[model samples]
Each structure stands twice: as structure tokens, then as C-alpha cells.
Target: MESLKYHRLQQRLGYTFVDQKNLQLALTHRSHGATNNERLEFLGDSILNFVIGEALFKKFPEAKEGQLSRLRSQMVKGETLAHLAREFAFGECLVLGEGEMKSGGHRRDSILADTVEAIIGAIYLEAGLDSCRDRLHSWYAERLAALSLETTVKDAKTRLQEHLQSLQKPLPEYNIVDVNGEAHAQLFTVECKIATLSQSATAQASSRREAEKQAAAAVLARLGL
Candidate 1:
């Protein structure tokens, strides 16, 4: 990527690096070469968990430990990180190897998510924890504002399972009904079957995990739980 692109990215991140090289390495993927972003990713992941954990604790003082943990998990998951990456157009700045480049690694969720963490690490190394926390807050402002204990009491699957367990009912089962589309843009159709329900709840999404979540969500609606 060009210097102009990095400058634009820094503008989006709300933090400019004292040493631009750190940012460069943060944007580098392992596929690019040996000295890549893996270590930085490790550091950044820890920092993010700590920073977000503290933020959640302060924002939701009444939340129990389990609620806080689940909320943090949702925030730091690969899906949410990838969403943040897309917000900053991280794909345009990622440095990938030839093979990964040709295979659309720039748009891959795991890759994008890792780069976001790497960037967080880079920011900390260039400046300090305060800068890193500020950037995270900027990126997550809308999401933080939207969080509610009622809406995220539990994930759809967890809620469904708990409802069943409460009544001494058997657990729900999930199956892959179909998978379609190309390698990078595939869609998964998952069916959720509960012993008490006459019909199965089905949903489709870009990944099996997401598909299952949707299917579980559908089942939640069906059971009115």
C-alpha cells in the first residue's frame, strides 16, 4: 500500500503512528512473509479485551459477570472485528502474499479481523494504552451505545437451550441443510430441530456459524422464548 493510503487509514483510526513502520507491520499478514503481524495480533487481542472489558464494566454496572463476559465475547468476535475493519476499509490497505492476494484474502473475515487487532497493537506500540483505548472507543461508539441487557441477555441458541433444559426437554439439534455458492462467497443453510416443535426452523447465511445463529434465532421466535 502507498503512504497516502496509510495516511487515510490513520485518519480513519484517529491515531497517527509516531513510527509508521509499526503500522506497516501491523497491516502485514503472515502470508506476506516471516516478519508479519502475528505477534502484534497477540498483543492487540489482549489489549482489546482489557479495554473493552473495562468499558463494558463501567457502562453496565449492574451486569453480572456472565453477562459482561458474553457481551465482551460478542464485541471481540471475528465477525464484529471484521465489521469494524470494513468500516475503515482495511481491505484496501492490507499487505498479503501473492497466493492469498489472488484468493481474495483482503476480503476474508479472519484476515480483516486479525488486521484490526494488529492495528490496535501498532497503535499501542507507537503511542500508549490511552491512544489505543481512545481509538477503540471511537470505532465502537455506536455499538456500545446500542448495547442493552434485555436485547443481549443471551444468544439465541443459548436461550433456546436453557428454555428446553428448564422443562426437562431434550436439547435442540442443528444440521446443515445445504451449502451453495463459491469458495469465498458461500451460503450455508442450517435447520434447527427441537423435540417439542412440529416443524424445523431454518436459516441461511454467509457462514455456517452465522447460519446456525440465525436458525437458532428462528427457533427462539417459534418457541416464543
Candidate 2:
């Protein structure tokens, strides 16, 4: 049954593993056992950065170094990887330990993001850089097409701040409402409040910065920006 599910995931990914064990290893979290996807994730991270950077270099020859760096960062960020993971329905395919399973580890952004990288590494190992690059290009086709030098990719907080400034409203305030879990693996809840607006937005994430960013994004959504 599990193998059948993985087969479906391969179809979705548009790459079939020559050795099924590589696919299984890529999906196995550290919590599952000592032999897990951490090594693959590391390799995949480097490959992703290099491939995306190369693509951006070719796509925008006139772009400055900073612009290329920022573009690559935006494309390879954990949030973007998590979004891709959701699109691929990767949560159901994750292999986690009993504790992690009970705690909804499969749905975690970090886990999903790491799993995506791990799969990339697995593909590189099984085939080669050419095959890995082709897969990445296919995966990021829409996102790559959307890129442009005319508009810079700004983070949610920066966009929110600039938007409010244009409307003659005071900058938004962020407050930490709650913190949960262990020190190393904490969850932070942040509330983003705009004085001019009656409604505020709150979001939770593994870090304060990320939670604040999410809160700001929520406020932007409310304002239809």
C-alpha cells in the first residue's frame, strides 16, 4: 500500500526512482531512524541553490549580483518549498516516527521543505546533474516565468510597511502573543496590528520573525493588497 502511494507521488513528481530505496530514504525523517534524509537534504540544498542561481543568471543577464541573490533566496526559501510540497501532496507520503506522527510532523513546513530537497538529492544520485536540473526546471516553470526585473521580490513585512506608508497610515506593530514547545523547537504566535484598521491579524510559526511575516501577510490579504 505504501509503495503504491509512493508510486503516485513519483508520477506527480515526474521522476521515477531507479532504486525505490532512494525514494523511501528521501521521505524518511530523522525521527524515523538514524539513517534518514538529513544527508540527502544537505546535498539537495546545495544543488537547488546552484541550479536556481544558474537559471537566474541565464534568464536575466542584466540583473545585478544583489538582484540575482535576492531572486534565488526568494525562490529557494523554506516557505516556497513548503508551498511546492503542499502542491505535491507530500504530507501523506512522509515517513516519520511515532512521536512525530502524533505531533503532526508530516504537515510541518520545515519537514516538508527538507523532504523536497531530499528528493532532489535522491534524483541527482540516481541519475545526474542534467536530469536533476531538468526536474527542477519543470517544477519551477511557472514561478520562473513569473520572475521579472521590473519588480523586485520583497518580503511580506517590507511590502506591508511600504503599503501602509503610501496610505498615510502608521507602520504596523508586531507583538508576541504566545510561545510554546521546547526552547530549541519553539512555536511563536505573533499579532500584527495596524492602528488605522480595526481588525488585526495573528499567525504562528517556528520562529518569531516567520510568525511576524505571516501575520503581516495575513493583514495584506485582509486589505486585498
Candidate 3:
């Protein structure tokens, strides 16, 4: 079932194999390949840690182990791998049999992410670490943003800062523009500014910090920042 197009894609990945079957096996879904990429994915998970961890070690010498570990964790998360798989359009290339295809298998994160690891394992098997590392870095370039989504989405300030940084900058600034009426019935107007983009919101509160957060939310919506 080899095709020139698939072969060209394999060449782009930089690992041409004698048995292309392992590579094919890696791409197969459980519905198609029986055992599927699960086992390969497990092996790839460790290989990914080894490769990305080594990368972090070299990339940030001054970073403490905690910091480096955090970075690696971000890279290898299921959501991150799923996003990375999309970037390479791996979802489109997944070889699902009739049953899995009918079940929308391509959209499954566990499946797609496992395929990514299996492909990495296939690379490792064919050409070893250097080749596999190169393919992985190229594949993972875009999903690094998923890391900036923060340790959790519940922290608005952290999310906002990360969104800004993904654009290569720091958090936006909010300034109190006006306070209207009397102290008992005060209204605050706060402006959130990021570079040239600005948004303002007004809220009644007993203190300034609460009003600032409202303004920040407005700015986030304005720039989608």
C-alpha cells in the first residue's frame, strides 16, 4: 500500500526505511493495525522526555531542574502533542480502517497524539536519536504556545500574560481614567493598554484592585489579548 506521496512525506521526515512497515505500523490505528500505536507511543513518550529534556538542558543552562522539568512537561502534554499533530496535519494522514473512520477517529486526541509518538518511535527505529530529534523539533514548533496557555486556565492574569508573551511582550497596563459620582456610589473607568491596543471598562467597587481586573478582562476581549 505504499504510495509516492506518502513516501515523499516520509522523506521530508528524514528517515527512509528498509521495512517501511514499522513506519506504516506506527501510523495505523488500533481499528486498523490491531495493537496500534499504543506500545510504540509508550516507548516514544520516554524517548520524547529524553530528547526534549536534553534539549532543555542545553537550551537553558542557568535554569534550575524544576524550571527545565516544567518546560519539558509542557512540551509533552497530550494537548500539546495533539496540537503538534495537527500542525503537521498528522490527523489527515492517520490510517484508520472503515470502523474507526466512521467513528471520527481522526479527531481523537488520544489517537492522534499516540500516532505522533509512534511516528517518533518509527523515526528512532530507522535512523536513531539525531534524526528523530530533528523531526520532533520541527513538528513541535507551533504548539509551544500551548505551554503559554499557562499551568491552568483558571488564572486570568497568568493567561493574559501568557497570551501577550506569545505575541512577544509583557502584560498590558491598566490605568484609572476616571471616578464619577460620590464615594458612596462611585463608578470607576479603567483603561487596559497593550502597545497600541486599548480597552476600557467601568465598574462600581469598594477598591481599585477589583476595578482593575474588570478593565483587564475588557482589554483581553478587545485585543482578544
Candidate 4:
């Protein structure tokens, strides 16, 4: 039954493994056992960076280094990867421990994202670099094709700060509204306050920086900028 499920997942992923065990290992979470996907996640992370970097370089020949870097970061970030995982129904295929399973670990963005990377590493090991690159391109096809120079612009926080500076208005301030969850996987809630704006904007994420960015994005949206 497990093999059948894995086979279905492989069909969805558009890649078959020569050594099926590698694929199984890729889907196994750390909480499942000592021998889990962490090593594969590390390996896959390096391969992903290189594959995406090369694709960006060729796709945007006229783009500068900073622009390419931003594009690559957006492409491989946890949010995007988690989005892809959902599209692939990766949550159905994960092997998590009793604790994680009860807590809905498969639905967690971080876990889903890490499993995607671990699968990438497994693909490379079972097949080869070219095979891994081809699979990555296939998975990221629509996203890569949609890239534009405008998408490489600075993040919301930087843009908001610059907009305020241009008008000589007081800079935006970010305050931690709340922090929840365990120490290792904390969720930070941030409130962005601008003196010019009457109301504060709030957002939450797994990290302080990401929470701040989310809050800034909300503030920007509220300000209609």
C-alpha cells in the first residue's frame, strides 16, 4: 500500500526513482526517526540554488546580479515551495511521527517546503544532475516563465520606507504584537504603524523578518500604494 502511494506521488511529481527507497526517505520527516530527510534537504537546497540561479541567468541576460539574486530568492523561497507542495498534494505523501501527524505537520508550510527540497535531492541521487535539473524546470515552468524585471524590485518594507522618506513623513515602525508556538517553530505577529496612517496594519509569519514584511505589505495595500 505504501509503495502504491509512493508510485502515485511519483506520477504526480513527473519523475520516477531508480532506487525507490530514496524517494521514501525524502518524504520521511525528522520527527519520524533519526534517519530522516535533513541531509537530503541540505543537498537539495544547494542543487536548487544552482539550478534556479542558472535558469535566471539565462532567462534574464540583461538583468544585473542583484536583480537575478532577488528573482532567484523569490523563486525558491519557503512560501513559493509550500505553494507548489500544495499543488502536488505532498501532504498526503509525507511520513511524519505521531506527534507531528496529530498536530497536522503535513500542512505546515515549513515541512511541506523541506520535503520538496528533499525530493529534489533524492531525484538527483537516484537519477543524475541533468535529470534533477529537468524535473526542477518542469515543476517551476510557469513560475519561471512569469518572471519580469519589475518582480525583482525591492521588498515591501524597503519600498514603504522609501515612499515615506520621499514625502518627509515619519518612518514606519514595527512592533511585535504576539509570539506563539514552540521555540523551534515560533510564529511572530507584527503590527506596522505609520504616523501618517490612522490605523496600524498587522500580519503574522514564522519569523520576525517575514512578519514585518507581511505587515508592511498590508500597510502598503491599505495606503493604496
Candidate 5:
């Protein structure tokens, strides 16, 4: 039953492991035991960066180094990886400990993202770099196809920074004004201040990073950019 459950994930990944233990280990969370997927996640992160970097380099000969770096970052970031994990129904196959499982750790973005990377590492170890590359390419086909120098999907912070840089204006400043709630789930209130603008934008989210992003987006909307 356990093996059959993972077989479904393998089909989605488009690669089956020779030694199924690799896949099992890759899905194991640190909370599950000492022998977990952390090492595999690290290896997979490096491989993912290299593979995505090489792909971007070939796909866009005219792109600058910064552009390629941004593109690769966008592709390999936790949010993107978590989205891929959702696509593969990874939450159902994650091997979390009793506490983590009870607390809905399987649905966590970080855990899902880490598991995806671990799986990548497992594939690399099982076969080779070519297999890993092929799987990544297959998985990221739509996202890769959508990439373009002009339409690069950038975060609000990056876009705001670039906008300020182009206009020779002072960069925006972010300050955390307030934090509410407990340790596990806190609401952060961040204010984005622009030197030229008379008014600042404030936003709140579950994390400081997200709050800052929302504030930046609000500032951008004010600027009419």
C-alpha cells in the first residue's frame, strides 16, 4: 500500500526510482527522524540552480547576467517549488512525524518545497545529471516556455527597486510597524516609504516578507507604474 502510494508520485515526476528507498528517504521529514531529506535537499538545490541557469543561458543569449539570475531565482524559489509539489500531490506522500503530521506540516510550503528538491536529488543519485535535467525540464516545461526578457515575472520588491533605479530616485524603505499573534502564526504590519511620495503604504500579512511585498505593490499602484 505504501509503495503503491509513492508510485503515483513517481508517475507525476516522470521518473521511477531503481531503489525505491531513495524516494522514501527523500519524502521523509526531519521531524520524522535523524535520517531525513536535508542532505538531499541541499544537493538538489545546487543541481536545480545549475540546470535552470544553464537552460536560461541557452534560451536567452541576449539576456544580461542579472536577468538570468532573476529568472533562475523566480523558477527555483520556495513558492514555485511548492506549487510544483501541489501539482504532484506531494502532501499525500510526505513522511512527517506525529507532531508535524497532526499540525498539518504536510501542507506547509517549506516542507513541500524541500521535498521537491529532495526528490530531485534522489533522481540525480539514482540515474545521473541527464535524468535530473530531463525531469526538471519536463516538470518546468510550461514555466520555461513562458519566460521572456521583456515579460520576466518579478516580485513586487524587485520591480519597485528597478523602477526606482531607472528613475534615479531614492529606493523605498520598509519598516515593520507592528506584529500581532503568537509565535507560530503572527501578523506583521509593514510600511513602505518612498522619499518622493508624500504618503506611505502600509500592509499586513502572516509574514514580514509578504507584508513588505504588499506594501511595495501598494506603493507601485500609487506611482501609477
Candidate 6:
């Protein structure tokens, strides 16, 4: 029944599934399958990276390799995938076991993103690269446009530094004023001072970089940077 629903999803794409199991596998969460979409997600992740990378490479022919990679990364990020899932309403058909269903597994970033990758993987396997490229771009066209507007996905700190540098202002500084939370999920409170306006944010992550990103996003919001 779940497989049929996923096939219906493919039909909605106006693309029939070459391998029904692949699409089914894509839809299966770890909580549901003895083995799950993680492996498929891994393959799909690479496929998407390559596909999105190539797309950007051609679209922005003058962009350097690093810039292209950053743009692709931004596009393939979990948040982007989750957004795609929402756009396709894939969550509505996600077949979660009882536990995951109760825990909001269908809407979770990890689940939704992985499912997206798996679906892409299934698409690639079924319809080949041309079809994959076509379908993927239909989703990514807007994202590509938005990315073209942004200078880079270089994060708020970079943007802030660049902004100050362009204006000949001193570099912004991030001071870890406080740290909170248990060992597993620590939150770092960072204060970013840019000229006379001081802004701060707390980022919670499993690692420092993650925390910094969270903090930077906050600082950007606070400073309107």
C-alpha cells in the first residue's frame, strides 16, 4: 500500500517508476525497515551533489570551483531537502512505524531530507541522468535563482566581515560570553560586535562550528546584517 502511494507520487511527477522497490525504499524510514533509506540516502546524496554541482557549474560558468561547491552544498543541505519535501508534500505519504509516527518522524529534518535523497536516487536509477537532471532542476530552478542573488553561502560571519571590510570598518568579533546545556547538547552564546551596534545569539549544536553557525544566524538577525 505504501509502495503504491509512492508510485502514485511518481505518477504525479508524470514519471513512472522503473523500480517500484527503489521508490518504496526511498519512502521507508529506519523505524519502518529492518534496513532503511540511509544507504540509499548516501548514494542519493552523492548523486545530488554531482547533479547540483554540474547544474551550477554550467549555470555560473565563471564561478570558481570552491564557489560552485559552496553553492551546491547550500542547495543540497538538509534544510533545502526538507523544504523540497514540504513542497512535494512527501511527508503526507511517509510510512512511519508507530514510534516514529508518534515522534513526528515524517516532518523531521533527518527523515525528510534522507527521503528526498532516496527519491532522487530512485529517480536516477529509473529514468537515467537526463531525466534526473530535468526533474531535479524543476525543483531547484527557484533555489538557483535565489543563490545567484546571494554573494556566497559564506555564513553570517563572512558576510559581516566582508560588509565591514567593504566599508573599511574593523572586522566583527565573536566572543563566547556564555555556554549552557548538558554535555551532549551544548549551547554557545556568542556576542558579535560590529562597530557601535552589538548583537548576540546562542547556537546549539553537537559541535562548535554548528554552534557558531547558529550564533551567526542570530547575530545576523539581530544586526540585520
lDDT of 6 by residue, 1-225 (tens): 766776667765556776677777778887775867777778789889988988898889888887887787789887889898888888878767787788677877667888899888777777788888888888888888777725566876677677778889887666776777544234566655667464345665434555566766776677666
Each prediction's number of clashing residue pairs: 0, 0, 0, 0, 0, 0
lDDT of 6: 0.74
Report residue 94 deviation for candidate 3 (angstroms).
1.6
Q: Could you give the candidate ranking by TM-score, starting with the highest?
A: 4, 5, 1, 2, 6, 3
Q: Would you estimate the TM-scores of all the predictions?
A: 0.78, 0.76, 0.59, 0.86, 0.83, 0.73
In candidate 3 the C-alpha lDDT for residue 219 amounts to 62
Q: Please list the residue runs of candidate 1 whose C-alpha ends up more than 4 Å from where it truly belongs after superposition.
A: 172-225
Model 4 bad stretches (over 4 Å): 168-175, 193-200
* Per-residue lDDT of model 1, residues 58-95, tens digit only: 99999999989999989998899999999999999999
On TM-score, the stronger of 2 and 4 is 4
lDDT of 3: 0.69
Q: Residue-wise lDDT of candidate 4 within 83-129, one digit each (tens)?
A: 99999899999999888898899999989999999999998888889
Least well predicted 10-residue stretch by lDDT in candidate 1: 179-188
Worst 10-residue lDDT window, candidate 6: 181-190
Off by over 4 Å in 6: 1-4, 145-153, 157-201, 205-211, 219-225
User: lDDT of model 2 at residue 58?
Assistant: 100
Candidate 2: tens digits of C-alpha lDDT, residues 1-225: 998999999999999998999999999998888989999999999999999999999999999998898899889989999999999999999998887898898888989999999999999999999999999999999999999975567779999999989989899999999999854257999999998779899999998999999999999999888
- Among all windows of 10 consecutive residues in model 3, the one with the lowest summed lDDT is 147-156
Candidate 1 residue-wise lDDT at 212: 87
Q: What TM-score does structure 2 among the candidates reach?
A: 0.76
lDDT of 1: 0.90
**Which candidate comes out best when scored by lDDT?**
2
Residue pairs in clash, model 4: none
Q: Per-residue lDDT of 79-104 in model 3, one digit per residue for the tens?
A: 67787677666766788878668767
